[model samples]
Target chain A: MHELSIAIQIVEIVEEEAAKVEAESITRLELDIGLLSGVERDALEFAMEEAIRGSLLEKTQIVYNFIKAVMVCEECCNEFNTDDYFNSCPYCNSLKTIFIKGKELNIKSIEILKQ
Target chain B: MCGTCGCGEDEHITYRNPNNPDSHLHEHSHFHGDKEHSHAHHHEHDHSHPHSHDHSHDYLLKPGGGALNSQTIQLQRKILSKNDLLAERNRGHFEALNIVAFNLVSSPGSGKTAVLERTILEKGSDFNCYVIEGDQQTMNDAERIKSAGAPVIQINTGNGCHLDALMVNKAMKDLKLPENSTLFIENVGNLVCPALFDLGETKRVVIISVTEGEDKPAKYPTMFETAQLCLINKTDLLPYLDFDLEKFRQIATQVNHHIEFIEISAKTGEGFNQWYEWIVKHRLSETD
Candidate 1:
């Protein structure tokens, strides 16, 4: 699954950041994954567990902040939550809706303990 | 780490010849630092500098009262930023060479290689064409493209589902493509993961054969939505299959209103001219 690749990338990013701060160990990591980001949460967690073995984040507690997909209708200005891209606006039945805030896949923060 | 997977850092991508069982190995290490960190920061205050202390003023400070200060670093960085930056570098390279690169994506048996073969056969004399073929572990596509009379390179991605921008950048260096040429990057035959990666192609063409169901556009909207053109291949077999052309078009258009579609049969050359014309026109427009 692509989740393994993504998980590895997350670990790499965390390791790089932790090295910059000279952290003894990472205590926690928070990720912001959106509903429309095309990532499965459980799969990512499993992949991360596999990816972090013997790595700097081996003991880190991972936290996920899932963002819900919200679409804004261009025709009727209606805002709705949806996971599908082909969804139409509920109020106006228009397919001209755009995603306002659902595609985010980011590492929001990381807690590191200094030696 | 393997460029595709982060298992280990020393893994090198090996390019092997399809025809020869034991051809000379061409090993290329994944280029690190190709992607620039857009969010690099410099702290003004130095944490390593110890604060001034007075031993006589022990009354002012209590021993063992202060706790270790753990820091929470705010990154707010996009997960795919590295790939995006590398893709941008590839775009810059393409622009500098005036090359129009097309990313051909499709299912395993969707005739992407056939389309590229036919395109090269028909237009090879008029233009310089280069191909970069991607597959999990095969040089068959590269062999086919080479036989079609064009320079071709094969990238065996071992375990990667899709070709990232870094792979393309490496392939470009090996290709030595000429200026004002068309580079066709035949991505690994999968619609899902490739849609998430940007290969710095000027245009993305997704091919779907008539043998497949009309619900493919609805099922994999991300690939259809990301593509600029949808080449509906195997129109010659439409009479025998139960594929609904109208329904497919409707769903595809609903998913991506800006996408252009062309029905063609690379075998019989039916509606193939239109496909070539579309490419030439877009290439001209991009250059202009």
Candidate 2:
């Protein structure tokens, strides 16, 4: 659903970067996807391919790296990695938790072939 | 090959490396070493290169895609930053116009529409009311507001789970909104994806009705934490439902202490006056 819109944003960013670096073709796009980012990787990839057609980023490979969700328990102060979107702390069973990492949707890097 | 440094400048650039003859990696490396020194590398080849191949220049783009002057542009563009930039643009636009737009988010059947309906009925005449309604289908909510005599536009997401700023921008175009209008955007009935997107709204109003369960604030705390105001709607249904209004307030406050909570029922016209008063106060403060 939001993947198509997200894909459009991806295309816009890549196109802007291509223009900035004065590059004619984009070879690779690297993305860091967080576990709790709620973005479907396969769906996003498929959407990106369809969205990038007839654009400057045609025939580009999208390299996505998924990061596991991590959080710190407010009660026990224990930090743990979890794939669970919602779960109590394993140590204290307390719902008071602060998210440390994951939930990140960023373009980590891009490889453009210079003309 | 040059024997001293193993740099291939010799007469025979063989596909086989003189060292490690039995290793497969050596054979593969030798193949690439010859490939890099192919006729394309030489300026005198008279096919592609007009200038002599500079030893200093790094020829990263392999000449593969023919005749479009195909230069591959390598970049590290943050996908989220693009939206953030547009979001900032929208924030600036709102600030310049002195308009306060709020994105209302909640679960389905959370009394968001009722809150708006009651709000419009009470204070629609005082301020220019405009709404951007997001739903999977039907302009029913928009129709309701239009009959109430407020400027309303319904955005049928078709299957979209959230409303992005770009869609808000398009919806605003048709609104013909006033210079300093108070725009209320009722996001699609979703607690998750809608929390991630920013619609250039000054406030993010999260509605939590009593029937959905008290643990809603604890379970889906992101929208609660992110919102500026948390309206606990449908208070009239509190007695029949096993919903603890006090417990809900306690958990919601723990998640967001600074957020203002208004418990009201848009239906039956109970506790709506307080919401109306708050809106007027906010609008006055903003305009002042």
Query: Which digits, one per residue and each the tens of the lDDT, describe model 1 over residues B1-288?
Result: 224542323133555444453553565564333322121111243233121222342332335554344789999988877778889899999998889999999999999999999999999756688898888876788889889998877887776678888878877887788789899999989988788788899999999999999999888887888899999999999989999999999898777778899999988999888998998997797688
Segments of candidate 2 deviating more than 4 angstroms = A22-24, A40-61, A67-100, B1-77, B250-257
Model 1 scores what on Cα lDDT?
A: 0.79
Candidate 2: tens digits of C-alpha lDDT, residues A72-112: 88789999887654566889877677677777788777666
What does DockQ give for each predicted structure? 0.33, 0.16
Per-residue lDDT for A1-115 in model 1, tens only? 5666677678888889899998776777889998777676666666666667768887677788889989898888999999788888999988777788777889999987674
Model 2: per-residue Cα lDDT at residue B240: 92
- Clash pairs (backbone) in predicted model 1: B1-B8, B1-B9
Model 2, span B218-270: residue lDDT tens: 77766776788888888888889998888887777666556788888888788
Instruction: For each candidate in the order shown, give its overall lDDT on alpha carbons.
Output: 0.79, 0.67
User: Which sections of candidate 1 miss by over 4 Å?
Assistant: B1-12, B16-24, B28-67
Best by DockQ: 1
Task: Report the TM-score of candidate 2, chain A only.
Answer: 0.89
